[model samples]
Target: MSVLNTAEIMEILPHRHPFLLIDTVEELESGVRAVAKKAVSFHEPYFAGHFPGNPVMPGVLIIEALAQTGAVAILSQPEWKGKTAYFAGINHAKFKQKVVPGDVLTLETEIIKVKGPIGIGKATAYVDGKIACIAELTFAIG
Candidate 1:
């Protein structure tokens, strides 16, 4: 069990500013599970047009953040380290609540199965202890 900081996250994930949605990983257990966070802010570029008067974090981006967290869990493994994880598919995605600026989204991912370069996981996004989004994501490591 270990906590990974932004520096460590950058080493594993290829995402950068305006796209690197994960702020910090608070918990990690190799291939088993992981938890991370993304602090939503009004300064985000997307907020500008997402709705000028009433900005809201886009649902797709929320799912992407969750998938990115799952990627961290998969890539953190020694054998998968340095590899890139691509979004293979998403299923059973649902947005239960709206995520807005000032929300600290807690992203949780648990590995459901993994075989070779293919991995499947379940992810959930929470804000203020309430689930905002949930999905079953599949990824392919290359």
Candidate 2:
């Protein structure tokens, strides 16, 4: 129901530059579902060696971005604030498209289940309205 800019996102997530992938949260429903965005640029340090002539965003980093977005969703819940969300597991992860510089990634996360300190979520990354990656990510509040 609200939008969270990078400043607000920093309050919930501990990630810093080169690791903090999300730029803005566009939609949120507390514990249910959320949508965020990240703008990939050539200025990112990782683009230097990710490839020489051809630069592609790393798949593992894509998953981490999705996980971070999911963490933001979980942390937005009143009871989960001020806690750290740690990646516990990842399942059925698939990378369907290559992410390059100048791409605006739309990240979506839906809570599948939440029990005590553990939470499971389904996450997907989209570019130009098409899915680029997807996975089931589990997190533990610490």
Evaluated at residue 29, the lDDT of candidate 1 is: 82
Query: What tens-digit string does per-residue lDDT give for candidate 2 at 1-142?
Result: 3399999999998988878999999998888888999999988788899997899999998999899899888998888889999999999999999999999999999999999999899999999999999999999999
Span of 10 residues, lowest total lDDT, candidate 2: 1-10
- Runs in model 1 deviating more than 4 A are none
Backbone clash pairs for candidate 1 read: none
State the lDDT of candidate 1 residue by residue for 32-122, as single tens digits. Answer: 8889999999999999999999999999999999988999888888998889999999999999999999999999999899998998999
lDDT of each: 0.92, 0.92
lDDT of 2 at 99: 97
